[model samples]
Target chain A: MVNANITNKMRNLRDAYSSALIELGSKNEDVVVLDADLSLSTKTKRFGTVFPDRFFDMGIAEANMMGVAAGLAACGKIVFASTFAVFATGRSYDAIRQSIAYPELNVKIVATHAGISVGGDGASHQMLEDIALMRALPNMTVIAPADATEMEDVVPAIAEHSGPCYVRIGRADAPIIFETHGEFKIGRGLVLRDGSDVAIIATGTMTAEALKAYDLLKKEGIEACIVHMPTIKPIDKKLARKVAGKTGRIITCEEHTIIGGLGDAVSMAIAEKPVPMRRIGVNDVFGESGEARQLMEKYGLTAENMAKVAKEMIKKY
Target chain B: MHDKALIKDLKRKALEIRKWVIESVYRAGSGHPGGSLSIADVMACLYFHEMRHNPKDPKWPDRDRLVLSKGHAAPALYAALALAGYFPVEELKNLRKIGHFLQGHPCMKKVPGVDMSTGSLGHGLSVAVGMALAGKLDGKDYRVFVILGDGEVQEGQIWEAANSASHYKLDNIIAILDRNGLQIDGPTEEIMHVEPIAWRWQAFGWDVIEIDGHDIEEILDTFHEIKMNEKPTIIIANTIKGKGVSFMEGTLSFHGKPPSEEQYKKAMSELEQEERELNG
Candidate 1:
C-alpha cells in the first residue's frame, strides 16, 4: 500500500517527454514527428530540432495532420502527431474515425493537456471526454500514461503497435512512481499494490491519487489494492477481473467526467462480473479556470477524496 | 491521339461500362447508374492509360494512389477494377449482393484494388491529401489522384482539405471533378449551385484546368500536364449525366435507376456497334 505522508516525490513531465522523443527520433528513421504548431507546448520541439526533415509543422491543422499520419502509416511510416487533447480529439474526431481507425492505421495520436488538470485554460481547452470519443472507435488503443517514466515507456510501446493508438499525457508536472523502467505492455494493467479489503482502479493523473489513498486506508487498518490501468480502451480485462474477483470492492478515479473515461472503461469491463464500485471524477460537470492543482483539489481528484471513496466501498462490501 | 479516334474508343468503353452498370444495378436492385455512366470514360482513361499501377500487385508501394471521393459512383469504379483484372468481369453481377465484395460503395477490405473505403462524401480528399503528403515525406515519386463529384465539393471539409493541400504545396496530388452536373437530388445547379468550379480551386492555389469529361485523349494529356505542373492540379471534366445511353443522357431520373430490360437491349446494341467500329 502507498504512504500518503511520503514527501519529496520527484516530478518531471515536459523534459522527460522531450528526451524520449529525441531518443526515438534518433533510432528510427521511419518514426516521423508532426506538430500542430504546438511543438514547444507538447515538448516535441526537441525532435523537430534534431530531425527537421522528419518533423512537420502542420500550422494548427489537426484534421489534416491526422489524415497525413494515416497516409504515412499506410506507406509503412510510424507517425506521431502531437497537440492539445482538446484539438486532437474535438477538432479531428471524423478524421481519426474514417482515415485512421477505419483502416487501423499505425498512427499515434499523442494528446497533451488532457483532463481538468489542464487548468487556467478553462473548460474550452481541457478535454475530459476524449477517452470516450476514442474508445467508441474500433481498433483505437487508448492509453493515459501515469507519469514521465510511464510516458517514456508508452511512446515506444505504442510506436511498435500496428493499429490506431491514442496516448493522453498530462501538462502538469507529476510524481515518478516506477523506481526503474518496468514492463509497460499495451492492453495490460499495472498493479501498484496488493490487498483484499478493497480495490482502487485508476488511470492517468489519478493513479497517484489512488496510491495516496492506499496509504490513507492503511493508517485506518483497512487493506486496499491499487491497479493502474494505463490502457483504458482495451480495459485490461485480465486485471479488472482478477482484482475485482479478489477484492469484490472497487473505487474508480480519474481527472475526467464520470460519464465516459477510465471510470466508464473499468465499469464496462466488470459490468457482468459485478462489484460494489464507486467512481470519483468530474461528475458530468465542466471545469473552471484556476491553477491545475486547485482544479484537481476542487474536483475531489486528491488523496483524501479517493480515500474517502475507498473507505466507503470497503464498508459497502 | 486524334479527337475522333479517342472519342470513338472512349465512347465504346463508356457504353460497355454503362451496360454493365445497368445489369449490376438491376441484379442488386440498387446503384447510382447515372453518375457511374457519366464518369465511365474518365474512369477508363485513368485506369487504362493515366494511372501508373500494376493489377497483379495492388499494394505496389510506388504506384499512384487513386481515391474515389465521389464514392457512390462505385459501379463505374467496379467496372474499371474488373476490366483492369482486379477480379473476373462476370463478378459484376454480384454487386450490392450479400457476401459480395462489389458493394454499392468501395471497401478496401472487401476488394483488392480499392485504396480506401469511402461512402461518406468529401472525406476521401483528405485521405488523398494524406497520401500525397506522405509521398513527399517518404521521398517517394508516386503521385496521388482523387475524383470528386461536383456535389461533394459543397462539403466544408472539402474546402478545409483543399486549403491544406495548397498550403502544403502538394504538387503530387491531382483532383478530377466529375462535372457530370447532376446529383441524386437533380441538377447540381438546381439543388446547390457549384458554378465557377475551376475558379474556386484555382483561388485555393491549385493549378486548374477545364476539359470535356468524355475526352479520353484530353483526360490522358491533362494528367500528364498535372504531373509536370508545380502545384496541385484540378481538372474539371465537364460531362453529361448518363452519357452513353440516348434516353438516359443528361437526365436525373437515371441517377440511381437501372435501365429496364428493353432499354438494356438498346444500350447493348449501341455498345456492340461502337466496339465494332473501334476494332475496324
Candidate 2:
C-alpha cells in the first residue's frame, strides 16, 4: 500500500540496502561490511549492530576502506564497502582500480548519496561521474537501482554474481515503482510499459520520472514505451536494439551528467543502427545547493521535461 | 636460538635468492635490482623459515599471506617463490617479458604463492590489514605479512592502514619496512622524510622492532620475539640498497635499472665467491 503523506509511495533506497545486507549476513558467515565513517548515513550501521564482528568502520579513510574490502574479498569473504558516492569513487579510485578491479576480487562497492539528488550538499557531495568512472574500469559491474524494491533485489543479485561490482543509490527517498518481486539479473533491462510512438530508457531514480512521463505523454495522445535499465556496464544490447528498432526515437533519463551515464551507454549500444534520441539529465555542468525536487525540475529531470523532449524530438525528427 | 646448521641453510637460501634476483633482472633487461636485492634476505627468511606455507598448496586457507607492497621489488618475490618450489626456477628468467606470468608487478591471479596483487604504491598494506582482519574474524592462526618500501611509506594510505591495523588490534599482521634509504629520484630523506620511522610505527600503536634487514640471525630473532605480540608489529629493517652486488650497493642508479652484461657477470661471480666461502 502506498503511504498517503508520500506521493506515489516513496521509500529510502538505503534502508533497503541495509535490510538486504542484514539478510545476507544472516545467511553467509563470510559476508563482511566496511564503511568510511558514513555508516550512519549509508545505513550499514544496521548490519554492524546485527553482526558486529563482520562490520568494519575504517574512519574517514575511503582509500584504506576500499583496499581493506579488497583484502577481505581476497581471503574469500564477500565484502561490501560503503560510503558517499563522491568519496567512494573519487577519493579511492586507484585503490578500487588496483586492489579490487584489477584482481577481479569479489568486493561490492555500494555508494550512497549519488547524483544531484543529494540535495543541499552541492556539486562537491554530488557524484555525477561515478558511473563513468566505474564503467571505464575493467571487470567492474556498475548498477544503479531504480527504487527501494529494485535496490532490495540488487543486493543478492550482485552478491550471487562474482567479481567486483559498483552499486549507486541516491540520498533522497525515491518513488517505489516495481511492486512484485522479480529475479534481478546483472545485465538485463526491465520493460515497464510498451507503446509505439517513442521509447524512454531510464536508470536510477529517473525510471520513476519516465513512468510519470508515460502518463503525461498518454494525455497528449503520444504513446511511449518505458525501459528501466539498472545495469550500465555490459548493458542489455539486445533490448536496446529491439527498442531502437521498435521506436525510431528514444529518450534517456538520468540524475547524472549526460556525458558518460545511461545516455552515452545507450548511444554506444545502438550506434550501429542510429536513432534520433534526447538525453534528459543534468547537462555537462556542476550542481548548486538546492532541494532535491527543485534541482530535478531546474535541471530538466522532471516528467514534464521528459514529455516535452519526447514531443519535440518526434516533431523535429 | 636457531641451530648453526639451520642458520647456515637460511644464509645459503638468502644467497640463492639474491642470485635469482640478479639472474632474473639480467634476463628481463629492466627490473628493480636495488630494492629486490635489498629484500632478498627477508624473502628467504619468509619463504624458507618463518611463514607457515606449503608451496605445493599455495591457496591453502590456513597458510600465512604475504603482500609485497613495494611491488617493483617483484624480482625478489618471484625468486623466493621459485626457490620455495611454487614454480619452476627457469620461469624466473621470464620476468616482465611479453605474456610472462611474472609481470612488472606481482599479480595474485597470475602467480602462485602471491597472496595479494600489488603494483601501485601504498595499496598492499591495506589489503594486508584486511587479510589480517579476516584471520582474526575466522579465528585462524595464519598471519598476514606485508613488506613496505621506505619510499612507499610516503603514500598516505600506508598510514591509514597502519592506524586501522592498530585500532582493530590485529596482532596477526607483521609488516617488514624495507628501509633501504634510496628511492628512484634520491635518498628518501631528501625526497620525503619518513624518518623516526620506528617511533612513527610505535606512535601508531605497533610494537616496533628495528634490525639490520641483512642480518639473518637478527631477522630470525625478531620474528621469534614477535610470536607473542598482542599488537600489530612492524619490523623496521634497516637495509642497504643494491646490497651484495659490489658496483651497485647503496647506489640510486640501480633502483629500477638492469645491470649491464659485464656488471651482471661480475655480480654473479661475486655471489659465487660468497657461496664458496659460506660452504667452506
Candidate 3:
C-alpha cells in the first residue's frame, strides 16, 4: 500500500549530496562551497570538513552569501552556495536574479529542505515557490532530483556545466525508486513505464508517489505511463509532445505549488498540441507544523490521491 | 602627494570623465547625473591610474576587479571603460538604447570590464568580499575595489557584507563610499542620518580613510597609505553632488534627471571651463 515500508530502505539525499561534493572537490580544484549558517541541516558542512579553507560559512546572511557566490564565480571559481530553500530562494531571490542570473555566472544554488516536507519547523521554514521563482529567471536552469542516486549524478552535472542553476533538494526520508543509476542529462525526461491509457509526469520526491500510483492504476484496470522530469527549465517539450501523442491524457505531479512551476512549464510545452491535463500539487495555501509523512498525506500528496486524480483525468478526457 | 604632473594629468582625465557623464546622461534624457558626476574622480583614478587591468584581455585573471555598488553611477563606469579602450568611445553615445551593450545599469554579460552585474544597491560589496576571499584562497595577488553610495549603505545587506569582510579578514579589499551628502529624496543625513560615518566603519572593524573625493592628490595618497592591518578598509570620499556642474551641484533634482536642453548647454560650458583650467 503505497510503499509504507520504503522509509526503512531510503537514504538521506543530503548524505549523497555530501559525497558528490567531496568527489567534485577532488576533480575540480576550483570548486568551493558556501553556506549561510545551516550547514548542518543542508549538510554542506561535510564539504567544509574535507576542504576546510574552500568552504565558507557566511553566518546566516543568505542575501550576502548569494552576492558573494556571484563574485567568486566572476573570479573563475565554481561556487555552490547552499542554505534552506526558504532563505535561499525566498529571502534572497533579488540577489540571485541580479548578481547570479543576470551575468549567467557559474554558481550552483543547491538548496535543501524544499516544499512542505520540511516538517516541525512549519510554514515559516518551508519553501513551495522556489521552482517557480527560479524558473522565471532568464538564464537559470532549475532541477529537482528525485532521490539520493539522482542527486549523485545531478550534483556533478551542474558543477561541470558552466552557468547559473537552481537545484531543489528535500529534507524528508522518502523512498528510493531507482535501484540502478541512469545517465543524467539536462532537459531530458525518462519514461520509466509505458502505458496507453494516461500519463503521470512528476518530479522530486513526488516521482516515487507517481510510481506507486502507477501500480495502483494498473491493478484497477487502468494503464498509466510514468515520466520522471528532473530538470524544470529547458523542460523536455519533445517528450511532452510524444507522451501526449501516446497517452492523450496527462496528470502532472510535483511537491511545489501548482502555479508557475512544472505544471505551467508542461502546459506551455504542449500548447502547440493540446491535450487534456490536470496538475496535481499544493493548491494556493501555506503549510503548517506536522510530521513530514503526515504533511504529505494531509496535502493530498500520496499515491492514493494521485491515483484518484489520474482516474479523474482519464474520465474527464 | 608631491607628483603634481601625475595629479594634473589625473585631474584632466577626471574632467574628461565628467564631460562624458554630462553628455551621455543629457543624450539619454533619463539617467542619474548627480551620483554619476559625484564619483568621476574616483572612477578616473581606478580605471586610468590605479587598477592593473588589460582592456584587450577583459577577463584577465590577475586583474584588479572593481564593483560599482552605487550602480546608478553607471555612466562614470561606462565612460571609464570606454576611455580605457575596453570598447570604442563612440559606444558611450548609446547609453541605454535598444541594441546597445550599455544598459540602465551595469550588466557584466553585455559590458566588458564590468566584473559583476550590479544595479540594486548594497550588493556589490558582498561580491567584492567574495572576490577577495577567492583570491586569498587561491593565493592570487589581485585586489578587489568596491564603490558604494552613502545613501545605498542604508541597505541591511551592506552590514552583512561588512561582517563577512571583517570576519574573513579580507585585506585585499577596499570599500570606497561616495559620500555626496545628498540623495534623491533629500540629504542622506536628513533622510536617514548616516552620521559619524567614519566611526561607524571603524566600529565595523575597518581602517577608515576620510578624504576630499574631488582632490586627485588626496585620493592618490589615501590609496598609497592603506596600511596592512589584516582588515578591510573603507575610504570615505567626501564629494559634492553633480561636482563639475554649477547649477546641478547640491541639487536633488539632478540625482536621477537629465539636464534639459538649456540646462545641458549650461552644464557643458561649465565642464568646458573646468577642462580649460585643468589644461592650464
- Cα RMSDs, all models: 2.5, 2.1, 2.0
Whole-model Cα lDDT per candidate?
Answer: 0.83, 0.92, 0.90
Off by over 4 Å in 3: A1-8
- Shift in Å, residue A10, candidate 2: 1.2
lDDT winner between candidates 1 and 3: 3
Best by DockQ: 3
Alpha-carbon runs more than 4 Å astray in model 2: A1-7
With candidate 2 superimposed using the best TM-score fit, by how many Å does residue A127's alpha carbon deviate from the native?
0.9
Residue lDDT tens for model 2, A1-317: 12111147879999999999999899999899999999999999999999998999999999999999999998999999999999999999999999999999999999999999899989999889899899999999999998888889999998999999999999999888877566468999878888889999999988888888989999999999899899988899899889999999999998888988899999999999989989888899999899998999999989999999999998998
* Alpha carbon deviation, residue A122, candidate 1 (Å): 1.2
Residue-by-residue lDDT tens digits, candidate 3, A56-144: 99998999999999999998899999999999999998899889998999999999999998999999987999999999999999999
Ranking by lDDT: 2, 3, 1
Candidate 1 lDDT by residue in tens digits, B145-173: 89999999987778877888888889998
DockQ by candidate, in order: 0.57, 0.86, 0.89
Q: Interface Cα RMSD per model, in Å?
A: 1.7, 0.5, 0.6
Cα deviation in Å at residue B244, candidate 1? 2.1
Query: After aligning candidate 1 to the native by TM-score, how far in Å is the CA of A6 from where it should be?
Result: 6.9
| Model 3: lDDT of residue A184 | 67
Residue pairs in candidate 1 whose N, alpha carbon or C atoms collide under 3 angstroms:
none
For candidate 1, what is the lDDT? Answer: 0.83
Worst 10 residues of 3 chain A by lDDT: A1-10
lDDT of 1 by residue, A75-163 (tens): 77888998999999999998888788887888999988888888898999889889889989999999988877778888888877888
